[model samples]
Target: MKLWFARVAGVSASQMLMVAVAWQMYDLTNSAWDLGLVGLLQFAPSLLLTLPAGHLIDRLHRGRLLATCMAVQALCALALAGASAQGVATREALLAVSIVLGAVRAFQMPTQQALTPLLVPREVLPRALAFSSVGLQGAVIGAPALGGLLYALGAGVTYFVCTGLFAVAAALCLWLRYAHSAASSEPATWHTLLAGVRHVWHHKVVLGAISLDLFAVLFGGATALLPIFAKDILHVGPWGLGLLRSAPAVGALAMSLALTRWPVRRRTGHTLLAAVAVFGLAMLVFGLSTSFMLSMAALAVSGAADMVSVVIRQTLVQLETPDEMRGRVSAVNSVFIGASNQLGEFESGATAALMGPVGSVLLGGVGTLVVAALWLRLFPALAQRDALVQAGTAEPGGRARA
Candidate 1:
């Protein structure tokens, strides 16, 4: 419970910080390029530091590490607040802080993922993951609006609020108690750093699940073109664009709640593949729909389908991995997630430029469908797997569950 609240508050604080930072940057420079640079600078550190951070997570105490991350984020928020209050916040300062946040996130993400299985029994992990998604989706939906409201009061006020949230989250993390201990002390070397990559490469089920998300989202994402759809095709303006943006998260939150109530218990692999296929079908509907209502519905369905896939994939990965290696394996999984989202946006933009928006979306949808079909044949072990917890695997908490 402490972990759940910590995750919600931490995620909410992070989202609010992003909104305030982006608005502050735009207010100062009014340059789209500068805004894009902020995002790039933030992402760059994750690419460089995540693997090493994962190694440290395995060797150190995860809860303490997460608390430290939140503390650093709190300090960053305070710095931004101070700068905003002094009317001295600059583009350069924002860019540098973004790099710091990115680096902290590289550690925070894997620590959070690796810590969950330690806190919960393996039998309830699927439901716990589903419940966790509910909080995340809610924060993703609500925090930005809260930040915008707080920003109207002042950017300093928004930052102050974020600082408070981070502090509270850090306190919660510090309060958490779990049974798992850190891995045995090992010298940091190339072999240890690359273990995650090697593990993923050799574990065909993990490889299939993670890569499926990478390719599926890489081809099927249409978020980059939402503005185009709202203005030209739907004729709904900014208000409608906001709805389109929120629609998927709304669907995901609802689906997560359902999954928590009645978790997937059988044929988990086939279920994951079907969910991805449904997501493709939803994207296809969204691409072809002329009605705003239809488009909104399609996006909602896509979100719900994607939620199913997320719950299954995360549960599978956590259950398959031993406690000692969870941090490293989760780091590899996070990279796949980050790549799919970043590259998916780029793919959507590039294809939108070559073909029209509708055509690009249609192509992406078809491509996603084809990938789903191909993966069924490509990963037979995953497709035929019957249970989320294998018959005789050791759980992260160290007990073997049948």
Candidate 2:
């Protein structure tokens, strides 16, 4: 729980910085294309560097790697703060900083996911994952609120607060520990990277589950073009923009906490599909709603429903993957997940450029539903599977299965 708390703090700090950056960028440029460009800057580095970053995670001491990344991120935030304070903040500089931060994130995700099982027992992995998701979602909710408030005070204050938070996170990282093994001592190379890809491709359940969420979220990604919705359609300012960004996180947090008591059990496949379908419907609702309250509510609903898909997909990845292979497999998974976010931004940006933001979002919702329908037809075996948990099947170290 202590480690989880620290993770929450760190994640919240990062997210708050993101919200501040997005708002500041939009305010400075007053363009939807600029909004998408921020995402693009972040995406390119993660997409390009993920494999090497993941490999390094497996090879290095995870605790040290994480601390270094946090330190770098803190410095980056401080730079942004300085730029903002001087009235020299430019969109180009923000994009450059975003790229550096994205490179840091490329290394962050795999190391974090690979380290989870080490902290908690495998049996409670699902619960732990749920809690972790809660932390992330909670940050989504809180960061933007705090960020908007800070922005109201001044952009410099927002960036300063973000820098301070990053420093706090770095200090907190010193308290979290991981149990290393012979597996982590292996060499990192191109050959090893290829092996990881092969492992993921051969594993049907992992491939199917990751692909499922990737496709669904990729097509229905509305968050990418939020600036347009906030300014034009919803007629709200920075505070309202923060609220719109946070609505999904609120819904996701509610669902994550609820799942602690009633864990997802039987018909896992069907449940995943159902949750995604609901997400699509919520997206459609969000796309159509012009009222600020209604649009935020719609986004919140979409977020809550999407949490179901996230838990199932994450649980499957943890439970199915072997410890020795966790880093590599997760790296492959990162590509898909990262692409879903980055490419989705590109898709939204390109589409919005052509056919207005509202139409682009509506079409994305339609695409999400269509993909879900096709998935249901293709993976019937997944739909028919019982609980993801198996009684006698423990992990390699006699630990209970995730």
Candidate 3:
């Protein structure tokens, strides 16, 4: 748990830097497209290196790999700080920093997910995941506001803070004493590397659950446009952007607390769909709202709705997957998650360029609803799942029971 908290702190700090950088980029170019570009650059590493990174995690000491990754992230943060201090934080330089940051996370995120099973007993992993997510949700609640305020002082100050937090996170990784699964003895070969891909491809229920999240969030996410909404749509400043960014986290945190106590134990499939549908509605409401309070409320509701799917999907992925392939499968899952989030930002930016921000957002919300409905038909086994634990007991490499 200490390790989890420390890593969460690092992730939160990185998120803070990201928020400030997005604000800075928009301030520099005053273009929503650039904000989207920042996300695209950050996620490119996931697209390019995550599969390999996942392979490495399975074949290496995940804790040590995480420590190395965190240290590298710190250097990237320090470099960004230097660039800002030198008055050389051009859009291109910032983008370059984002590319490095993205690559580091590409290696870090799967290892992080794979590490969870190592830290706790399998039976209680869902509960542990809920607690683990609290660190993230809490950080989301606080870090954006902190970053916004820090950036208000100076962008360099914000980057320096990130640098320190990442270094601390790196140091914490050294203290983890738990034993993780040993490296796979299989020789490093392309066939072995692609095993994780084949595993997901063959599992209909797992594929369905993952695909549901990928498409819904790919359309429903509106984070990349928050600065635009803060400045133009809501007439709020940087602090307001922070609040806008934090609203969903607040909702997610609250929901996480509730789930920690109750835990989603029944009819998880229906619940997942319902949560996603609510998320879409919230986005639609947020898109049309002129009032800041109303916009925040809508976003908060969306965030809360998103947590249900996150918890359920993550639990399903880890519980159903065999121990030997957790890293590779998680890498695949991260790719889907990264595409949905990063590419969603790009998609939002491109669409915002063609349509107005409000129009683009509205279209995305409607598209999210369409995806939920379509996925319901496309993966009926997933939709009919009754319990998170009992749903995927069959072979992960075989057909899903309908």
Candidate 4:
């Protein structure tokens, strides 16, 4: 629980900084393309380093790696805060901080995820994951809103608060304990580094789940263009932008809590597909709605739907992967997730430049729906999945038999 709390604080701080920086950028340039540039810079580190980072996670103390990453992130936040104090429109400096932040993410994601299972027993994992999801969703819901409020006071204040949050996270991480075998002794060879890539490629269910998110949310970058909506379309101030940014997280948090109360024990695959489709539909509604309240409602609904898939996909990937392979596999997973948000933002920006924000968002929604439908046919194994918890210690392909 201490670890979880620390993570929540750390993430909350990051989210606060994220919204503040994005808002600052949009305000400076008044361009959707520049907003996307923020996402792209954040994406760069993960794209370059995820594979190596995964190998390192499997070969290092995951807890230590995680703690170290948090500390670095705190430094990055501090740097951004320093920059922001100079002026609100510190786009160049904020963008530089993003590059550092991306490097932190590249190392942080897999280490954090791989460390999760080690914190609890196998039987307790699902519940733990559920609670973790709720915590994360809650952070998303509250942090952005808080950050927005802080931004209203001053952008520098928001950045400093974010720095403090990262410090708290790092401190808490020092106390969390776990037992593990010695780090992997394998040489960091090309073949060895690529092992995770091959593993996810061969695991049909894993591949399907990861790919679904990659495309679904990749196109779902409609959320990335939110500064435009808040400033221009909705005419909401920074506070409203924070609220708008947080809507999905609120829905996701509610859904996660419900799942925690009554876990999904059957038709896990079907649930994932249905949830993605619902998410797409909600996005479609969001794109079309003119009223601020209605738009928030649509985004909230979309977030609720997204939580279902996130839980299932995350649980399935972790449970199916071997202990030795978990870090690498998770690293592969991170790339997909990172790309979906950052690259997707870039895509949204490019398309928005051509077709306009509304058109871009609407098209992305349609694309998300199409991906869901196509996935139902493309991944028969994933589609046919039933249970989330395995019956015994079965390998990935043989889990059904177990």
Model 4 ranges off by over 4 Å: 393-402
The TM-score between candidate 3 and the true structure equals 0.96
Better of 1 and 2 by TM-score: 2
| Candidate 4 C-alpha lDDT tens digits along 1-402 | 777898899889888988998898887888888888888888988989988998998888776788888999888778767766776446687688878888889888887778777766676577778899899989999999999999998788998888888888888877776665776677899998999899899889999998999999988657678989888889899999999989999999999899898888899889999999998999888888889999999999999998888888888788878878888889999999999988889888888888888999999999999999999999999998998887763233111110
lDDT (C-alpha) at residue 246 in model 4: 95
What are the RMSDs of all candidates, in order? 3.8, 2.5, 4.1, 3.5
Decoy 1 TM-score against native: 0.85
Weakest ten-residue segment in model 3 by summed lDDT: 393-402
Question: Which ten-residue region of model 1 has the weakest summed lDDT?
Answer: 393-402
- Candidate 2 lDDT, 111-146, residue by residue in tens: 677767666777787888888888889988988878
- Candidate 2 TM-score over all chains jointly: 0.94
lDDT of 1 by residue, 1-402 (tens): 888999999988987787678667756875444654565566678778868988988988788899999999999999999999999999999989988987888898889999998877887888889999999889866776677677878889999999999999999998877764646778889999999889889989999999999889878877656656766789865446546766787789999999999888889889999999999999999999999999999998999999998998898889888878888888888777765664465567667767877988899999999999999999999898887766765487542121
CA lDDT scores, all candidates in order:
0.83, 0.78, 0.85, 0.85
Which residue pairs collide, candidate 4?
Answer: none
TM of each candidate vs. truth: 0.85, 0.94, 0.96, 0.96
* Candidates, ranked, TM-score: 4, 3, 2, 1
